[model samples]
Target: MSRRHLAMLTATVLAAASLTACGSGDEPGDGGKTLTYWASNQGASLEADKEILQPELDKFEQQTGIKVNVEVVPWSDLLNRLLAAATTGQGPDVVNIGNTWSASLQATGALVEFDDATLDKVGGKDRFVPAALAAAGAPDKPPAAVPLYSLAYALYYNKQSFADAGITAPPTTWEEMAEAGRKLTGDGKWGLAVEGANPSENAHHAFTFAQQYGGEWFDAAGKPTFDTPQNVAAVKRYVDLMAVDKIVNPSNAEYAQNQSVSDFANGKAAMLLWQAAGANLKSQNMAADAYGVAPVPFLANPPAGGKQVNSMVAGINIAVFKHTKNLDGALEFVKFMTSDTEQVTLNKTYGSLPAVGTVAADPAFAADEQKVLAQTLATTAAPLPQVPEESTFETLVGTAIKELFADAASGRPVTEDSVREKLTRAQQQMR
Candidate 1:
C-alpha cells in the first residue's frame, strides 16, 4: 500500500475509537456509543455506498436505538487502517475486508470468531459461495467474516479486432489461442498483452493455466507448487507468448492489472484477460456490443492429466471486531447488513453479488449483472491462498512479473532460472 493510504488508514483507527471522534459526552438521547464503521470503495462511488447504507443505518438506529458513524476507505487504505486498528485496539466496530485477507488479519486476532449464531444471521454458511466462504472465514471453522460479493475474471477481447483478423471465434485451448494470436499479430497489433513485469497478473495467469495444464498452487492443505514443472511449463508458455512466439506487445513492460483492458478497449490489443463487470456493459465507456465472455482458453491436449481450472476469486467480507466495546450493537448491524432484503439492495446498487446462493437465486436480484458474475464465481472460481504473505505481493510480484515478461519480449535475455529463483525466494520469505 502507498504511504498516503497508510496515513489515511491510521487516521481512521484514531477516529473509530478515540472517545473524542465518537462524540464527546454529547447531548444525544443515548449516553453516546457511536459504532464507527470503515468500508472499502468497491461500491463504485463512495456516495453510492452511503446512499445505499445510510438508510439502513438510519433504520438500524431507529429500530435498535444505536448510532453508527461510517467512513468509506479506498482499497489501498483498508489494510493499513486494519493494521493500525488491530495493533492499537482502537478501530471501527465493523470492518469490510478482502476475503483473501482472512488469514492475515485473523492472525492479528482483530476479528471475532464466526459461529453458528452469525452463520444463521448471515443466512448461514450454505448461503455463500463455498470457495469464497472458505477464504473469508477461518479454516476448520465457520467464517469470521460474512461474504459481501465476488470479483470475477473473464476473457474480454475486441470484436472489431477479431473480425479484422478474420477470426470468427474465441480460442478454447492454449494451442488455439497461440495459433490465433500468431494470426492476429501484424503491423502495430499483437495477439495478447502479456506483462512479464506484472507478477500479480503472471500469478493469476499462472493459476488459470495450471488448471488448464492440470496442476494447482497448493494441495488441499495450502502449499506452494509454482516451481513444479506443470506450473513452470505453464509459466514458460506465457513467457513464450512474448519470447519465442512474439505475439504479445512490448508495451507490457509498463502494464499493470487492468492495463490490457484499456489496450483492448482502445483496439490496441486483440485479447485482454481481466475481471469482468457485466453491469458496465451499457456504460458510455465500454464497448459492450463489441465484446463477449467465455471461460478462459484451455490446453488442447493436456499432458493427459491437467485439469481445466477457471479464474481466481476475490471479494470483501464484513467482520466484527473481537474487542468492540459494543457487541450487541455490532451484531445488530451485522444482521442488518446480511438480511435478505439488504443483500439484494447492496448487490443491485454496489455491482456486487449476494454472498448466498439464495440471494442470487431471488427474483429480485435476478436482473442485476452482478448476479451473473456471482454465477460465474460459483461454478468456476478458484480460491487464492488465504495467507497474508500473498497479499504482500499485490504490487511487488506484479512489478517483477511484468518486468520479466517485458525483458523477454525485448530479447533482453530473461531466463526461467532467474524468474524461478525469485519466486522460490518469495515463497521462502512467506515462511
Candidate 2:
C-alpha cells in the first residue's frame, strides 16, 4: 500500500544521522546467524501480518539455520523510519518498501544494488514479472530492490447495492459512473467511499486522473508540472465527487485509516476504487460474492494527449540494506520468499498477484478479482514516475489534494481556480 510521507528529510539531517553510524555494527553479534527485518504491514493489522509471516519465517529458519527478527511497520511511520535507517545504517538487514518509493530510497545509496552478480546470488533477474520488475527502481539502472507483491486498482461495487439502485451494469466511463453514483446515493448510503485524508491514496488517484485527462505531473525532463490546465481540471474532477456530484460522503474527508474500505464492506457505500481490496474486505467479514470488480472508468471524451491508463502499478518491494552483515543469508531469504511456492502462498493470502511469472497459471490466482487485477496490470496500469524525486512529489501533491478534499467537505467551493492555486503551491514547494 502507498504510505503517508513525513516532511522531506533534509541533507543536513541525513549527514547528521550518518555521523553517528558505526560501520555495520548494527548487525547481530551471533556470527550472522540472526538478521533483522522490517516488514511493511500487509495483512489486516500489524499483528495479523506477524501471524501470517511467522510460519514462513520459521520454515526459512529450518531450511537455512538463520533466524530473522521481523518487525511489522505501519504505513504512517514506515517512510520516516526507513529514512532514519537508510541515513544511519543502523536498522534492518532487509526491508519492505512501497514499490513507488524504490527510486527515492535508492538515491540514498543505502540499498544493495541488484546487479547481475547479486541477482545471480538470489534468482536470475528473469524470475520476476517484467512489469513488476520495471517498477523496482529507476530506468537504465540496476534495481535497488525486487518485486514482492503486485497490484493494480479496480472499481469494486456492491452487487446488491447496484441491483437495489436499479443499475444494470458497472460503469464504463466517468459520466456513467457519476450518474450511477447519483442513483446509488440516498438513505444514508453514499455512492462512493474514498480515503481523502490519506496522502498516498490521494496521490494514487491523482496520478490516474491526471493520466486520463492528458496531464503530466512531471515534464519530459522530470521536472514538476503539477499546475497545468489539464492537471487542474483533473484534480477538480476528482474532488467534485463530493463537492459537486455529491456522490461521496463528506465524512470521507477524515478517512485515512482504511475506513473507506470498512465503509464499503459494511454497505454504507456502494463503490470503492482500490488496489486488491478483496483480502481487506474479507477481513471485515464481507463475503467474496458480495462485490463485483470492474476496470476503473476512463474519460468519456479524453483530450488530445490522453492515455488509456486507469491504475498505477502498485505493490511492495524487498530490499537488502548495504549495511547487512549476513549478505548470503539475506539473499537466501529473498530467494526463498520469491520462490514459486512461497509466491503463491503469500499472494493468495493477501489477494495480490504474484510478482513472479511462474505462478501466473496457478489455480489459486484464478479468481474473478484476480483476473481483473491481472488484466489491468498487463494492459493499462502505469507506474508512478520512477524518478529520484517521485516520493517527494507524492507527498507534496498528495497533501495538497488532501487539503482540497477537506475544503470540499467543509462546504467550501472547489473550483478550477482553487484547484490550480493549490497545485501551483505544490509545484512551488517542489522547487
- Among the numbered candidates, top TM-score falls to 2
* Clash count, one per candidate: 18, 0
Model 1 weakest lDDT span, ten residues long: 18-27
Q: What tens digits encode model 1's per-residue C-alpha lDDT throughout 74-143? A: 6545675676777676667888887766766776667887787767664566776676677775466556
Candidate 2 clashes between residue pairs 3 or more apart in a chain or in different chains: none
> Ten consecutive residues with minimal summed lDDT in candidate 2?
1-10
Cα-based TM-score, every candidate: 0.77, 0.94
* Candidate 2 wrong stretches, greater than 4 Å: 1-7, 10-29
CA shift of 201, model 2, Å: 0.8
lDDT of 2 by residue, 1-431 (tens): 11222235444345555433222235547666887788997777888889999999999999988888888988776776787777666778889999999998898888999999998887899999989999999999999999999999999999999999899899989889999999999999999999888888888899999999999899878888999998999889899989999999999998876789999999999999998999989999999999999999999999999999999999999999998887888889999989998999999999999999988999999999999999999899999999887888887888899999999999999999999999999988777
In order, the Cα lDDT scores of the candidates are 0.66, 0.88
Q: Give the TM-score of candidate 2.
A: 0.94
lDDT of 2 at 170: 97
Top lDDT model: 2
